[model samples]
Target: MTQHLTIVDHPLVQHKLTIMRDKTTSTAGFRRLLREISLLLAYEVTRELEMTTTTIETPMQTMEAPTLEGKKLALISILRAGNGLMDGILEMIPGARVGFVGMYRDPETLQPVQYYCKVPNELDARMTIVVDPMLATGNSSVAAIDLLKKQGARNLRFLCLLATPEGVARMLEAHPDVPIVTAALDAGLDDHGYILPGLGDAGDRMFGTK
Candidate 1:
């Protein structure tokens, strides 16, 4: 595995991920699992955030305590599936700013085409975490990062519920600077661009659309 990719193997994350992968799991259950898993994943992803000591008066006495330093974190969700992960992460970091990037696959070229892109102010100043549920081909993921880099997002990290080996390779080759945090990395992608033995279409499963 590449150093840039961090596969979290916490028990809670694994448990919820397995439940989300089960075909018999209900839509509501799946959504709840994703949210639960996101909280654990967010904790791992944000572990390296900078902190500084600040003086504050406690109930007993005044004391200096560690607090998050610098600008507020920014989360850029690659919708619409990314929104599912984003919601739970937001719950964990309520003060963090939110952004959205929308892209749809171009059937003819099998490439991602941007339909929307919106980020908060001073993206360059804040550490940006791009959230998506799956990393299959890595085309969209790469494209999204390209756009963010163009907009001056330097310190970036990618958070996904699952990934495939092929997708990890693609991402490593294209955007090595952006570290990836995922719960599981499956065998590889299937014929139709789905992760094999992976939780079905995350968007459909999450929204109960299919």
Candidate 2:
């Protein structure tokens, strides 16, 4: 991943994102759309995966075939809401190694606090991708990246459904090498660290929680 952000604005991605953002979309409908859109985003995120040629005997003759190089990818999901995106991505990258990092914001300090973390072994040797549906304040995402770096992750990428400018800025400042891929970048964050004109509470919308 480059030291930049990529917004997957393909028609299929945008269409599904629009429906997901609508207030009338049911929990089942939203969840279904998220799963479908996740596959689309996965296409863009893994577009540049390293490929190597392998000698294979085709039905006609022997030939060289392109295949992905290196070990299975490591997907680190920022827990709770990240599961929504991770589920669909896992369906596509079925061989990927999965891990979870759980964190929550402190109401008083408005900072993220980590509670749980379990990552795969030899993270530095694999391509590590982090999934979180909404990048609101970036506090949690940055914190999660910090932990992953400590765990030996060298190649990192961040994927989200929606992002705020503040959040993106924070990530760039903290981890410029980790590129970000998102469906949309919203106007900004509200007073309480919520994205403006954004779908309210991604976890709640997907899980029917308040």
TM-score of 1: 0.96
| Residue range 12-112, candidate 1, lDDT tens digits | 89988998999999999999999889999999889889899999999999999999999999999998999999999999899999999998767566589
Runs off by more than 4 Å, candidate 1: none
Lowest summed lDDT over 10 consecutive residues: which window, candidate 1? 103-112
Query: Model 2, residue 136: displacement in angstroms?
Result: 0.9
Highest TM-score, which number?
2
Each candidate's TM vs. the true structure?
0.96, 0.97
Q: What is the C-alpha RMSD of each candidate to the true structure, in Å?
A: 1.2, 1.4
Candidate 2 residue-wise lDDT at 64: 90
With candidate 1 superimposed using the best TM-score fit, by how many Å does residue 165's alpha carbon deviate from the native?
A: 1.3
Whole-model alpha-carbon lDDT for candidate 1? 0.92
lDDT values for all models: 0.92, 0.91
lDDT of 2: 0.91
